[model samples]
Target chain A: MPVPDDRKQQPKTTADAKIPGAYEGETVTRRRFMTASAHTAGGIATAAFTLPALGMAFGPVFEKEQVRWEAVGPTEDFPDDTYIPRTITLSPGIGEVGKSTVYVRRYNDTIDSEVKDEYNDYVAITSRCMHLGCPVRYVEASERFICPCHGGVYDREGKVSGGPPVRPLDRFYTRVRDGIVEVGPRYSLNSELRRFSPRDPGQAIDGVGQYLYPSRPSIRKLPGT
Target chain B: MAKLPTTSGTRPRGTRAETTEAPATAPQRNKLQETGVSTIDWLDERTSLSAGARWMMFRKIPKGTNWFYTLGSATMFAFLSQAVTGVFLAMYYDPSATRAYESVRFLTNEVFLGEFVRGMHKWGSTVMVILIFLHMARTFFFGAYKYPRELNWVIGVVLLILTLAMSFTGYLLPFDQRSYWATTVGVAINGTGPLVGPYLSDFLRAGPEFGATTLARFYAIHMLLLPGIIAAMIGAHLYLVARLGTTAPPWIRAESSPELREDSK
Candidate 1:
């Protein structure tokens, strides 16, 4: 057979040659081609299966002010003790908007001290931390409020003791009249009131630096009217 | 009798002489031509591989490429999925801490299939996390991250970190006890960063507590801010991957087929 002259000058590489067998270069059998086609089909099916559940969930994600609060029970249900946290829904004030079921726990006194019978001593704190907003749990044994995010620690009175907390645990202004307890939005107190303190001095609205021991029913009022 | 050559002028002189002496006599050639035409007609009746090939290249691709290699594609798919799903969720989700938790309930229970789609988006994020990690691992084990490919590896690492951050930030959007207090702990931990710890904590939560503003802040960050940055990064990552073709294993060399091997000079 006369080889083409262009073949001599071309670089000799094994891959350039055609596959062997008299029939190999001719027709591919129906079976082998079918098998390859099946493989390709299988690959594509997998991709289709994983498109991610997208279109079905887009409507709810964009509406603003969509949450509403549904009250579960009453404040009296929250006993004087360190009550178990309750899942409460908050309303976002736009459209049909609403918040999630946030758990709020109520307590009569700091965990370390004994529970008090006084009515105004009640404090309700949001379980969320002040930083990165992670949930903060009361470590009753340690008398410290610990945040799960980055380990911010607060003393029993909710003052920042350690970790990254720039401020103390948030305090909910609450009211209990005629044996009915009600909670309101959180408000930042004066700087001195936000520190780690052992004695809240019962109801001293403004004593610069007087330590009232826990359960001290009758601490002197803050100096002045 | 010598048969006439059809379209003979273009045939190579040597090949032509060989064909004349071979078994391709006139009747045999006519018989072969008839077979070719009939075969094409017969193939039209069945699900031929030709049709399948076209589907494989396009339609079936979305379904078939579920392997770990397709994870990069899945991640892209998931992002779009989440964006779409998030739009639905945003309709019912409240950004204020006071209402955030309540709104989630309405979406989860009241809205039709709201829970399911939301749940899928929730779970999809988790799956994407797993897939991205595996893709990165595959790249690493194959040494696909070497030299020219190092930039891809770096982008991949950034993407992984962003995935984790997305999960972390999203954890708080629910405005539940878990979200609020859990984030509080996270913020406090960040507060441990020495001099500016408090500042950082304040910066993260927008205040000393997880309240109305904090929820709004987190919601904005989780929805608006992070997604944009991640999408941009993904675009860059894909561009780089496409520019650098799939890196074959360092050791394997492509060799000729058996037929070519026999003919090697």
Candidate 2:
């Protein structure tokens, strides 16, 4: 046979070079061809099985904004300066609809004098305790919220007053629109008082220091504390 | 063509003689065979899958390895069983504290084959744990962790830890009273550790106590984190095993040892 062109071609380390007759003519057998097609089909089927599962597992990450002002009826529904505990159905996100008890207290006077605006008009405190997740009961007579799980106590303003709670009671975002009151998502007090001093117990409410210490007379505290 | 010899008397009743005969249409058969061959060639050009498969399946293994060597493979089989069944069970398992119990009830009572899948996931986990322990014992007794296999041994230990973590986290996903109390105790036990114990316990619970966040955190770890870690470790362990080849049994090692021979002499 005549010498083929590129007879002195450089050595190829590619997979094609290693596989016999991989680049040669008439290399595939019927069985081998079917097997290869089956393999490709199997891979596609596996991806089909897994990709949807992965998407579903991570579906919450792509969910629309969960915190929105959901109307809780007219302003008359919540009397001025009175703590009214109401169970409101909240749709926080897609496929997440649930009822939550919120203590709505409307004050003609600003509850916290420092921040003046819509917050002065109303406050909606979530029943969920800041310590553990036990629902806090509003003790109207005591003007406080007490957690049955840990004896955590929060004042009317939702500030941590006693028990095991490390921080104040969590509050829901609230707004007054067209003589109607609406509540949004619950948020921790930690972010609002992030700039407060950690050392001083008095500044605990102003700072996030309250979150650092277990509630006073806490049975759960370490030995040194 | 010459007829091949056959035991005519032993032939099954009603069996067609044409089963042994050639295809009626030789040209069609030839065309079909040609198409198959070309398809394989087309695939082989793009991917060296056949070469890789041949290397994997036909690699030389030392003689006298025997069926005892199958424990590790059995353990791998159990792990795969757990993964597949766990995926199916996850479809109906709600991670929320309030809904989790209800969801599990729905899965077991209402959904078709959900109970079977759940049972498989539960029992597969138990089987995986047992198999891993047995495999480890076998490896230890055979002295397979020696020399070049040390890293694989370490990786195996890491896989064991991850597997245990997976089991522990999965225990809490059911949101039953038993799971709740058990997990609380588990978290409390972690809290008893020195220094970082409290912080670690808090992190695991996602707070000071077990509740919704605890359930969510445990669900995440069980379903995602531990599986990911275990998978990577398993890959490394298998790669090392393939690279080093399965270690010979202790008797074989002792028989081959020059020092042992010299001592005997």
Candidate 3:
């Protein structure tokens, strides 16, 4: 449908426009220029405060967290055959809530599958379930970690033996400092026990899962682990 | 007559001289009533607030409007109740992670009417959720969400989500065992989403784990962020409601005018 000559749209620029005030040299009207500048100024002013507030709020996402090593107990306390639960503060200053239970044991050569490494001198499993971060209790009889909130189960090696866990249970860097076993920063494991950057619970860092749910910058798995 | 605050010269001071049977024409201004009237007039003169008030209050609601129509107002009142109670509760309720549980315990056990106010906020949250749902159902069942009112429906849905967010964030304020774990699980559930999930959970917890500021974050979001958005959305929702009038119930079929009937015939 061809537009009629009378009904066609007007020119965009002030110079091209046929209106009385539109001069040949004027590309834009004063009103439009004022409005645009005012709006730009308002937008800039808004972003000035909004961006920083948003940055402060989201700063944790990109901010690297401190990796603090705390000794739980002596090496003799945690037997390789079983697990010992020790309370460790993952985040400091928030009192009891920040404290989490990590089940620690000396690496049993018979059961350990991942390659022998300096960090894994003692096998330590975080109490947070791989399913949804629920605190999983180590049942002594079954030799399995069980989540109470959701029915997730992990076997003796913290591998997902049954139930809803997407990957194996998360593990921490364990070291013997001055004859005492110390647990350090946490790191997640794929089904095959391959180490990757730490992920929140329920994120599967296996196969395509790694790319799909990538590691957060705040806390990454140990450098080059 | 009730005593009124005296303005210097405008009001007649001789209430004793003005008898009960004073003439209607020579109306000696009743200082008490005149004060009230003049104050209102002064305000209305500048703001024209009365017109807006009348416009909002005296809307021509559609026929077949019944008790069901009151659900929106009921939801609003529930929010107002929550806000009032929450403000008072905030006077004593500490947001510090260490003292949150203890503060709540103190509020419940010791402060005067603290239990009652806290209980209202707690129970009122559920009530608000229930009322919003009922209001939504009314909107859905009556076909009020169709046509020009769709934007209002979208606003309403936003409000509903914000309300639920309020519930989610508010759940953690007590900092009890249930709250701590529930938030953990909730934040984890948030992490189950593809691509953005990991970052979102980190943002919610303020780190890879629930850290020092998570409780304060939740509290600020619950009381400050969400409430402001919800209140603004409600203002928009009500404005649309007033502007669009309302849909009659599904049962009430439109009655054609006599002119329309004759034209059809």
Candidate 4:
């Protein structure tokens, strides 16, 4: 017998390879076409619901936070030397869970050396611990805010004084409108009291922390402050 | 299954013929039994699903199988219990921060059998976690995670993590002081990651601080999202387990047939 053809020859098209019901120069088969169409339809159907559901859950992260100024009290209620604890509503719809305690006092020029900005006439400190978000209590005797979960301590100036606090206690932008001191949205501070956009507790904004844990888009400080 | 190895006339299971191994002559059947058998037969004829049922159910096990093997089934039943109780709990549960605690209080104190069901869901979570760990330990100590079984181990690890996520999200549903504070610390712990930590916390709470939507977000994740993924993963895991028969305990030595031994020699 003559030697069988051992040389390789690539099939130019499905028709050349003699696939069932093939036409001249055709490169596709009906079965393959049906399978691809089915798979593509399945993928599209899955993504149709999946993408919107994901967006629904994750929409809050990209949405800008609301700004509100709730009056704490008249200017005389907060003394320059000591903090007066005041409850403010952060999230309004919830009854009690939305309320958070803030220690507000008049900005003491002698101790508070940070450049006197328009927003700093009244100093308001959030009781949320820097270690975690647990509410800290102001100790009148010690002049420090203390966290109960972990022993986090903050000084009179809202700086981390001891324990596992990563930074100072978060603060709210204070402004006097109509002779009443109103606390605005929250802003986080580093150890040096340098203001940054609001961050959750346990995020340090000093050194590389500022870069590692960048400010979120939702909650930010007032534009000029 | 190639066959069920029975002398019964090839009528499907749950019939008198299967038990007695009756000859092809067959036996008289009650009308109820007739309806049931015919209904199953109709489905089997259309789908040929009986073969798959037998293939999954009639798997062979090694000679020294023991009670430790039951942990996987136990864990699966625990998950079923959790799913049922959690569904009922959601009926009375309000996911809003304002009403969440009140809803839970009503569920625990007022609704009939609500406390019992809630207790089952709350305690059953711990039970499921324990059973999963035990199953994982059995797999690990027996060296069953070798070679072809590695993919199963990977799936098991994913399931374990998902169960933990369920616990974390579920812990915050009560909206009590304890649950709220615990979730705060937990989210804070999540925020300790180097680069993505801050964003992770935000995504979990739906914003920087635990805001208005946080409770609702946790509820959705706990009931809807994680459970769906978990159920899908469990299906895949069981399919793999059925496809690949389980390994014998490490203490049980392999024993070949005398003929095979002689041939090898």
Candidate 2 runs further than 4 Å off? A1-225, B1-40, B253-265
Which is better, 2 or 4, measured by TM-score?
4
DockQ of each: 0.07, 0.04, 0.82, 0.63
Q: After superposition, how far is residue A9 of candidate 1 from its true place, in Å?
A: 56
What residue runs in model 3 are displaced by over 4 Å at the alpha carbon?
A1-24, B1-31, B262-265
What clash pairs does model 2 have? A28-B37, A29-B36, A29-B37, A30-B36, A30-B37, A196-A207
Q: What docking grade does candidate 3 earn?
A: high
* Native-interface RMSD of candidate 4: 1.3
Instruction: Pull out the clashing pairs in model 4.
Output: none
Tens digits of per-residue lDDT for model 3, B1-265: 2223332345564233223454576566655566577678667656878889988998887789999999999999999999999999999988998899999999999999999999999999999999999999999999999998999999999999999999999999998889888899899999889999989999998888899999999999999999899989999999999999999999998998777776634
Better of 1 and 2 by DockQ: 1
Error of 3 at B162 (Å): 0.1
Q: Per-residue lDDT of B160-246 in model 1, one digit per residue for the tens?
A: 888887777888887666665556556656655544454455456543333346667677777887889888998888767665656
* Tens-place lDDT digits, model 2, residues A1-225: 987697666445333345554554444545578999999999999999899976654443233323356787788888765688877754332122245688887764545422444443677777766554556898878878988766888777777788866566656657788988888655445534321211111113434344443232101211221
Q: Over all chains combined, what TM-score does candidate 2 have? A: 0.50
Two-way lDDT contest, 2 vs 3, winner: 3
Please list the C-alpha lDDT of all candidates, in the order they appear: 0.57, 0.67, 0.89, 0.87
TM-score of each: 0.45, 0.50, 0.90, 0.87
lDDT of candidate 1 over A89-113, digit per residue (tens): 3433422222322333456443513
